[model samples]
Every structure is written in structure tokens, then in C-alpha cells.
Target: MTISNHASVPETIALPPKEFSRTLYAYVVWGGLALALLWSWAPAEMDRVTYLFSDSGNMVEYASGFLTPNFHDWDYYVQEMILTVQIALWGTVLSIFFGIPFAILSSSNVAPIWIVQPVRRLMDACRAINELVFAVLFVVAVGLGPFAGVMALFVHNLGIIAKLFSEAVEAIDPYPVEGIRATGASKLQEIIYGIIPQVAPLWISFSLYRFETNVRSATVLGVVGAGGIGQILFESIRGFYYGETAAILIIVVITVTVVDLLSQQLRKLAI
Candidate 1:
């Protein structure tokens, strides 16, 4: 009798054993201990010693007097606000102009290591100094005005925008750039033809975000005598003109909210 030929069957390989439950338990234990340690450090006695919430009536009184808000000084608020808007706009434009080139030069794929690393380090160093610190420094240097505020926003934002733009460049897909290079395109041409199109949306989005942030920052720059709505707000609060402070706060809150909403809509349209 002849037997039919058949191929030998392959054995199934076992999957490595998993310790999912054990790993989950470890995470839970770590989280609980961390929370417990935080809670223990913040003693209940510390809260009582501080007058933070000692008298609820004091807070209620302040709120009642100030929360109503007096917009009778609307004209002054509007003028300072216009100056604040100007500072933010100028700052954002300067940031975008300087930042894009720095980002390109600092990117590894775009620039050689010798060039890229130095530019990156410089940008990081610039960004390490806080915007408010720069504002204070510039205010001192320029003798206090909107120009000081503008310069503060310009330097700080130049660094920040550069970092963000470089990150965007690094995160891009390499295929398009490769394809362009394959066509005998130079490095700059490859970037201009292939990478820029993909990165433009993200770059614009970051710029808008910086613009909104600059607006808020420009407001406070005045408090240091750089000149903006912050100076008005600070003086009013110092003199115990609580109603005036409330009105200024209302104006600022409304303006910022509008900018935020507009930016959101623009981003949506962009995407």
C-alpha cells in the first residue's frame, strides 16, 4: 500500500509570559505612597497658623465691593489696551521673522552639526531667561516705556519661536525631503520644495499661540513701568481704588478671551 505524502506541521511558538497584574500593582502602590507623602508634608496646623482663610467675611466684603466693576473709566482702559495690542503684534511679527531662520539653521537635517549645535545652544540660552525678567531688565535699560516692553517680548519670543520651529522641523516626515533630494535638488531646495509645505501649518499655529501669550505678557510689562494697562491696574489697586481695579480686570479678561476665541477659530480654519 502507498501512503500519500504530506508536509510536516510547524509547532506553535509560545508567547513570553506577562506580568501585567504585578506591574499594575506596583504603579498603584507608587501612586498611593506619593500622594500620602504629599498629604503628610502639608500639616493641618500650618493652614490654621496662616491667615489665608481665617475670615471668610473679609473675602466676601472685598468681592462685593469690587466684583460689581465700574466701567465709567472705559476711555482710559481702551487707550492702554490699544497700546498693549500694538506691543503684542509687533513682538509677534519680530519673533516670526527671526525665529524661522534660526529654526532652519539649527535643525540637524537642514544644517551640519558644527552649525546646528551652536545655534541651538544659543537659542536655548536666550529662552532660559524668563520674559518678565527681560522686561524688567529692558525697562531699566530703556528708562521705562512701551519700547522696553517691545524689546523684552522681541528677545524672549525670538528664542521661544526658534525652539518651537526647530522642533517642528525635526518632527517632519523624511520621505518628501528624500524624494526631492533624489531629483538632484540641493539641500536648501529640498527643504523649500518638500519640507516647508508640511511644516507651514504647525509654524503658523505656534506663532498664533505666541501672539496670544505676548498680549497677556505685554499687559503686565507695564507694571514694571514699561507702560501698558498693568500700570493702571497696579496703581488703582495700590491706592485702594478697588472698583477701578475691577473694571480694568474686566476689560483685560474680555480682550484676552476674544483673542483666544479668534485664535481658536483661525487654528481650526488652518487645520
Candidate 2:
């Protein structure tokens, strides 16, 4: 009797039977169609740029030259680079200063419908414009330098900080906030004593992430004549001084890597 029961094994459904394999074929067909469309539709954007593929020799020569660099004018780089760091450091600090409050105001638990709705909308408007666009306009108005980059970083970081801080606020322990209200604590006191502590570390971690991002952004902003190593890079590309361009790129990679690693360490600590 036991053997008979054992012999009648439980039937198991295949986790992925033959029918599921058809999905892969569907993707294959979809991908083929996409490639065909891309090939047939030579985009207008591509037509505008002087694509290097058409001039293969020049591209090769430039890339080869970029492998070797002359850093004799490294002294000049020191001054301009300091300003870039300053822009990023200041932006990160200033953004956090004001953004934390907005985050609290925009969070549903901490704020009323009238406050949260308008504040969230305002944050959205701030985020709509890219940092580079802000820098471009400022460059035209304020003249070419770090000051314009500062203003650009400030506005962009403010929006980013606000958004992240609000999310952090939303994710906090609701029990604490509720408990504080029950004990006769005022709204401000409850936020100060109960809510802020829970999420402050996360806010710091987010700010560090934003700082790392801004450092990279600051480099690109210089390409549009804002300021930093990208200015040097832009000049190298224009003058066919590929060697200097390569050195600038190396420096940028090191800068970004260091900032990224430091942020990672901070994140671990915060967590």
C-alpha cells in the first residue's frame, strides 16, 4: 500500500513550459523591426553632426595622440580646479540647508494638503530644467566663469535635495510621529524631536550622492565654457591637441572615482 501511494507521485507543473519560449522569439522579431527602422530612418540629428566614422583616419590619429600627454601647464589647472571644487562643495551645503525644510513641508505625514500639494509642484518645476541649461543662461547673463556655475549648481541641487529629502521623510516610522502627537507635542516639536532624527542620516547620505553627481556635472558645464577641465578639453578637441585632451580625461576619471568612493563609504556609514 505504501509503495502504491509512493508510485502515484504528485504531478508538478513545469515552471517554464514550451509556450514561454515563444516570448523570446517575439523579442527577436521586435528587435529586428527596431533595427530595421533605425537603419532606414537616418535620423536628422545624425545628419547635422560631423560624424567621425566618415573620416576614419582622422579619428584614429586623434585617438592615438590622446594616449600621450604633456602636463607642463599643470599649474594653471590647479587654480581653475579649486574653483570647481568650491562650486560643488558650496552647492551641496546650500542645497541641504534649505532643502530639508521643503522636504518636511512636502511630505504628507508632516504637512497638510494645502502645503504638500503646492510644495511638491514647486519642487517638480525646479527639477524640470537641467543644471546645464541653467549654466548656459547664466553664462550669457553673468559672463563666462565659476560664478555662473555656482548659481546653476545651487538651483539644480536645491530641487534634487528637496525631492530626495521628501522621499526620506515619507519613508520614516509613522508610529513615532503619531506617538509624539498623542503626547501633546506641537507639530514643530514632534518633527524636531521625533521625525528629524530618524531620517537625518539618510538626508546626509543623499547630499553626499548629490555632491558626487555635481562634481561630474561641473566638469561638463565647463565644456559649454562655464569653467573647469572641460574648457581645456574643448580647446584640445578644437585645436586637434588630442594629447592634452587625454590628460584632462584621465584627471576627470580620477576626480569622479575618488568622489564616488568617498560617497560610498559615507553611504555605508549612514546605513
Candidate 3:
């Protein structure tokens, strides 16, 4: 028997002409588009950088005001901070309530295509629009207040929560679901007995996470007249109440940090 030294041979694969051409064309097209965008914006970008660098002292002066956060109107700042938390709490609760059903409807494994597609599209629309924009619209409709902030947070969070919950539903282990179905459980029963148990922890975790975000968003909504700490912050800035602004900043930071830590601990316990 002749021993062939074929093990050392390297196999070379050649790209097909069509595939090679397509790849080259894609690269060239993308590169050209990137270059075109850079060319169009380069001058303005350079000017912006130059302007910022040339007036760095003003930026430093503005930031320095926050160092000694004035708590002159501690009562008003605390009141608004509490209100922001309230708005976020209510928004998170409402979003979870509404989102659960939509989430079920949107899941491919749970609902028919007719229901899933429409529900998903609606969620897409809700998520596509920012909370600030929604807050603006609600302010126009409701004439400003925490109610508007709640509505904005509710709508936007619904979309996000639905998307997250649906994904959780879709990723469930099929064994429990099959067992429930095999036991002659109804569609709703199967989900309640199988799917809900599996995803409930995740859903809770998601809700808590969103609640934290909503707290921060509540402040921003206020700036747009939705009534929260953001409104106070906005006014302080506009009226150049740097000391009050600093105080509000301190309150917001402390509140958010404390809430974040609590949420983190709760999440750890949950899982």
C-alpha cells in the first residue's frame, strides 16, 4: 500500500464570480454612502467642535453651579420629586395591566396571525414615538398635569412591556406547554398553567426595570408641561435659578439612586 501525504494539503475554495461581484458591489455602495454623508456633514461638524472648544470656560462656569446645590425651596423640590415617583408608579402599573394582554396577543405561539400582526404593529407604532412626544400630545389634549405624564408613560411603556413579555412567552420551554395541552386544558388554561408560570418572574423583573426608567422619564415629561420634577428643573434653568436647579438636581439624583438600589435588590430576590 502506498502512503499518500495528502493530510498536509490545504484546500482552497474560490468565490463564485456572482457572489464575489455582489459582495464587492455591496461594499462599494456602503462605502460611497458613508463617504457622501461624511462629506456633507464634515464642515458643520468641524464648526461645532471648534465652537465648543473655543468657549470651554463658559461650559465650566455653568457646570460649577451644581457643586453647591442650593436647597432654598426644599419643600417644593421634595413635593415635586414625590409627585414624579407617583406618576412613574401609576404609569408602570397601568402599562403592565394593558401590556399583558397585548403581549399575549402579540406572541406567535399564543395567538393567531391575524391578532398577532395587528397587535405587534400597534406596539411598533407606540414604541416608535418617544415618551416626550406622547407627553406633548397628551398635554395638548388634557391641558397639562401629572395625568398627561402618566398617560404618556403608560402608552410608551405598554409598547415596550408588550414586546418584552411577548419575547418571554415565545422563549418558554415547550415541555410544560405540551403537557398542559395534552391534559385537555383550554387555550387560556394552557397559557395560565404553563406559560404564565414560566414568564412571570421575567415579567416582574421587566416591570421593575421599566418603573425605574419611568421615574426618570417622569421628570422629563414635567419639562414639557406634564407636571413633575422636570417642570421645576426646566423653570429653574429658564429663569436662571442656578441654586434651585442645583437643589432639584441633587434631589433627583438621590431619589433615582435609592430607587435603583431597591429595584436591584428586589430583582435579585425575585430571580
Residue lDDT tens for model 3, 11-101: 8877656777889999999999999888978666754777676889998888887777888789989999999999999999999999999
What are the per-residue Cα lDDT tens digits for candidate 1 across 55-151? 7788788788797777888998989998998989898899889888899999887889999999989998879987778889998898888888888
In candidate 3, stretches whose alpha carbon ends up further than 4 angstroms from where it belongs are 1-46
Models 1 onward score TM values of 0.83, 0.81, 0.85
TM-score of 2: 0.81
Descending-TM-score candidate ranking: 3, 1, 2
Give the root-mean-square deviation of each candidate in angstroms. 6.0, 4.3, 4.1
Global Cα lDDT for candidate 3? 0.92
Each model's lDDT: 0.88, 0.82, 0.92
Collision pairs in model 1? none
Candidate 2, 138-158: lDDT as tens digits: 899899988788778888878
lDDT accuracy of residue 34 in candidate 2: 93
Of candidates 3 and 2, the better by TM-score: 3
Model 3 lDDT-worst window of ten: 1-10
Q: Which consecutive 10 residues in model 1 have the weakest lDDT in total?
A: 1-10
For lDDT, the strongest prediction is 3
Clashing pairs in 3: none
Query: Quick one: ranking by lDDT, best first?
Result: 3, 1, 2
